[model samples]
Target: MTTLTTKLIQQSDARGSALAVISDDLSLTWRELCDFSLRCSTMLRDKGIEKGDRVALLCSNRPAFLVAWFGLANIGAVTVSLNTGLVGEGLRYSVTQCSAKAVMIERAILDAKRADLEPVLEGRTVIVFDGEQDLFAVLSGLAADAPYEGLGSDPLSIIYTSGTTGLPKGVLNCHEAFLASGRWMSRYLKITEADRIMVFLPLFHTNPQMYAVMSALEVGCTLVIRPKFSVSNFFDDARRFDCTMFTYVGTVLSMLTSRIKTPDRNHKLTRCVGGGCPAEVWRAMQERFGIDPHELYGMTEVGGWVTGNSAENYRFGSCGKARPDVDVQVFDPQDNPVPAGTPGEIVVRPKAPFTILLGYWDNPKATWESSRNFWFHTGDAGTLDQDGYLYFLGRLKEIIRRGGENISPFEIETALLDHPDIADAAVVAVPDPIFGEEIKAVVVAKRDFPPQDVRHFLEGRVAQFMLPRYVQFVDEIPRTETQKIQRRQLQENDRGMIDLQGVEEHA
Candidate 1:
């Protein structure tokens, strides 16, 4: 009952009538969830899917997704949660990469990408949910009900995350890790069974899986699931379920603050938890919406969250203080520890068991390299203050070295986002003969915004060295489902740029 493998059954027996999850308008109690999950496990086991089997799950935020996810875990199989936004080679790459024994997809997605998924789906056991099979009845006809053998350290899921370069690597995480993170997060957020947490973020991402899905089970709370993030519906959704807390990435807040005509300052939400929240967005959330944003730093490599910001010990601009369960440090290019407040590569090692991921699936080289010097090198640029608070700069590779100065694209992007007309912004390092790397800012604005005005807006706000030499107006900015700007893609993009130096010289 300690492990997530058996927590479902325990919750069922102890809180059978307690509301477990809500999707759209339908709700399920703990008993119903346990029953449904067991059915999924039975059906899969009946189909020869035993322990260690890999199953690709490409579905949206719904009840069926949860059934398949938990069902896979119940039998000790690994669930490969594929991003629903993937198409063509990206979709095929993840399915084949994991060597998934089966694929549980929504009918809607299967129909749309059948051509791209045909090769991998040809011989695999494909279970399309959302009307394909009556899950409640699938196991009614079966159940040899022998003793279930599962371990907490057994991998519960393999989530695929793309790095700054190369193909995506599969991060193999275990039940103990998920269970531990849930408990840590519950305590970090002060979550209780009475706190109804809203999850509009995709479950494929680690935020929802660890913070929302697993946390709910850890504390026996309610989860209100929405299909996807909606700016217009956010105000009502928060109040609709009377949700006390919600999970967020910075993009969600930016969208709500910008797109919504009037920010929902009167919602019942007290706090939100997640990372990638810039200082501007963090303060804006507090002033405009009355929600205290808890921005933590995390990656799939070292479980869910390494450091957290909370009411007890909090910092406005920093990601937060290191969790009591992990040792967080910053290292220089030579992997040596730097002085406090000195920007360097963020690294971590777990203080508790199973907090770090098992390893990259089938990639020993990556596994060994990531855990170099016996520490999980996060590859992110950040610093630790003397008080032990972590300040997250952008990715190390994305830092623009201009005239011997290292400039953070994240800093420039934050300043750009503050502009009245700019809707979205991403700053990337561009090649230059003189300084080796110049700055380029790709902006998505509300209307026709000139590049000079954009440059003028940043006059005194940022240093002259950090100001972008090239500016481009685009309709939209490329982002992953988790709201991370695809910086590698942006760095590779050199099209339609307006050279500010030439424009200034001509004027």
Candidate 2:
């Protein structure tokens, strides 16, 4: 009874109850979902996938992702979900990192990136999700019934890092680790059979699948899936599916609020869940969109969600309190615990009854580094208040050390977003001879507003040094498929693209 797996939740659903998942053209219930997953698991096992094997899913958000996540978890096989948006080099990097035994991809998607993927998964099995060589043809024809052998602590996934920093490294999380994440999230979110969570973020990312689907399944909550997040159809999707809760991030909320009209202002969602909400936007978004913005802090390496802004009980700028079973502390350089309100590295240890990830896949150095002192160093800098509310202060690597001042880009970006003409802003440090690094802001201006207007809007609101030297406007900031701005990329690109002559000339 202590052990947890997706099959247990699948079996918990009533015979004819509604538990839905939506792909582009298909929507299915719990009964059908379980059956489909069982069949898929059988086919995969028959194809020599055993306990602890990594099976890469290279398809986009689809019904197959839901089925594959459960089916793999059911049989103790690891599900490595790869983002389909990864192109030539990026696609190759992920596949190579995963070192998966097989990949389940859509033909159209695979065809587009064949040159890159062909070599990476060369000897491995390549099962298509759509077209002639579809997984349905192979899995459906197999015997539907198979003895499920679930491995408790064996690896459940080797999710590759987003490669925003450099190259993507595979983060290995075990079955028990995922089980704990799901259970804790269920408790934190107060998920119940009455709750119908809507998911639109890519399944490849841990948030949507682990926090959204797995957490819902654990509580027997109905799932409303979307292939991709659509700003135009978001509310309509929620209303159509009767979703009580939806997972969100900064960009998703930004997109939702950007439009002139919010059709379903008092929409169905009770709370829009996930992290990275600016404090200024949080109140306005709640007032305008009619949903409580619940924030959570997470990384792919450390299972799914670590902490979340609890519903009903809210914190202004903090992500939230840690789960009852999570051991969290803010530590300085030598790993000594820091005082409240002091920014330090966030470390987490598995509390009793829950499991922690073993390490990063095939990268012993990273594994050792991340797992030092029996704590998972999250590489994020944050402060915990006296009341235990954890305020996120961006990633440690993303923080800019400028003119003896440690500036949080998140603070600058949040400030810029307050501007009327700016739709979104990303701040990164560009090379500066004087201050060591200079602040440069790349903004996505509102369609109606020009770059000059946005630059003028932020002139006096922020400090002279804190203000971005270069304000470059683009149609859209380069972002991961998950909508996180790739700041490292922006920083690298800014060297050539931005004009840093004036502001740093004083420095």
Candidate 3:
């Protein structure tokens, strides 16, 4: 009963003239957004896109992105959200792997990667936005009405995982799950129509999409969209838009703390809802900006949040208690429940069906492997206190969390090995004060290679976040008997082996 279509319709009918979305160039009311979405949906249906078809959306955080997203959902079509930072092989692999029938991309992205996208765009519908000929022009004369026959359990979006170990897997999320997430956030965060939510994170990720965008739509609140996160203008933007609440991830809090204190820092902002709020920075933010930081723990696979710590009932280093509808427990490797305060894998079971991820798209092996024992196993190590408060310890998977982005060591190693001068490589996480973790690469090279040269080689091959911060060349890399790279050993031994500051200086 709580499908996205219903949420939009209800809001438009009730608050037709309320401001719903705001960006630098455009602002739309609830009625306008609902009407535009209907026209967009009709446009897609005219192009032969039917129920259950996959349509890829590759654009930055903008009004066009939201229009396309809602339009696809209106007609029961699945959307494959592509990260705007992706390029070349990574971009091609995502579209091809999902078997996207059509792609809607921004003109700037298309122009920059026309050569890389040519092969993937062949034999598929490609619609360009933010250009001379945009989606607005195409839907100018289209009817502002479309049939909504979607059920709550139908698939809504396919978000690709952050390829931490190998290739990225598409995580399928349903309408029911998304609606449940927004409802929970709306109640727990106490968000109301008067709240102005600032959304600076990428729209492709679940954090910004669910916590910021969807939650705003559900409550008929004004959503202030940003192209991307900006450290220098973060507080300025919030103050400029009179934002009441904002979401964050990674080192956004830490970066803000490092800035010089200003008198205008204390603005209309009152509440902060996000994960990865380090304990030190968490305290600093509240003291500096007069805002309470509510840290929570969840992932893309879980469909929404699992645990959250609010200002009223928060522990310094805890992620708070699990929701009433979710069964969250810490279990050992053998699947037995671990004692309180013991670190183990965090697993979850939703009380209602279709309130969590349906499964990984096109990867039954991963779906079955993760959801074994009737509980979806989260690849995160954490502990629950006696009071039911969750404390995140670390990642079970060998992925690096750099500034809130997941960087896969295997992906970096594979790219490093592509260089003729490098014979072997192993990537590991190094502790950092601001970013939480920075990447370090230990390589067995054929000859001496400058760190800058290696970075230049990986510029277009991988995302900017995946690039290594420190490079240490050695004669050989440690390996197991089965010829597996001993990453844990490398991580432990390299603590004092390389001068990270010197490497940065030279690079």
TM-score of each: 0.96, 0.90, 0.80
Give the per-residue lDDT digits (tens) of candidate 3, residues 434-492: 99998888877678756666677888988988887777777777753113366766777
lDDT, residue 356, model 1: 76
Q: Largest TM-score belongs to which candidate?
A: 1
lDDT of 2: 0.74
Which regions in candidate 2 have their CA more than 4 angstroms from the true location? Answer: 1-16, 22-24, 131-141, 261-263, 447-465, 494-507
TM-score of 3: 0.80
The ten-residue window of minimal lDDT in model 2 covers 1-10
* Per-residue accuracy of model 2 over 122-219 as CA lDDT, tens digit each: 78887666732365566668766454555556667777777567777887777666667767787776888778888888778878867887676676
How many backbone collisions does model 1 have?
0
On TM-score, who's better, 2 or 3? 2
lDDT of 1 by residue, 438-485 (tens): 899999988886788878999898998888899988788888766778
What is the clash count for each candidate, in the order shown? 0, 1, 0
Clashing residue pairs found in predicted model 1? none
Position 398, candidate 2: lDDT: 90
Q: Per the 3 Å backbone cut-off, how many clashing residue pairs does candidate 2 have?
A: 1
Poorest stretch of ten by lDDT in candidate 1: 139-148
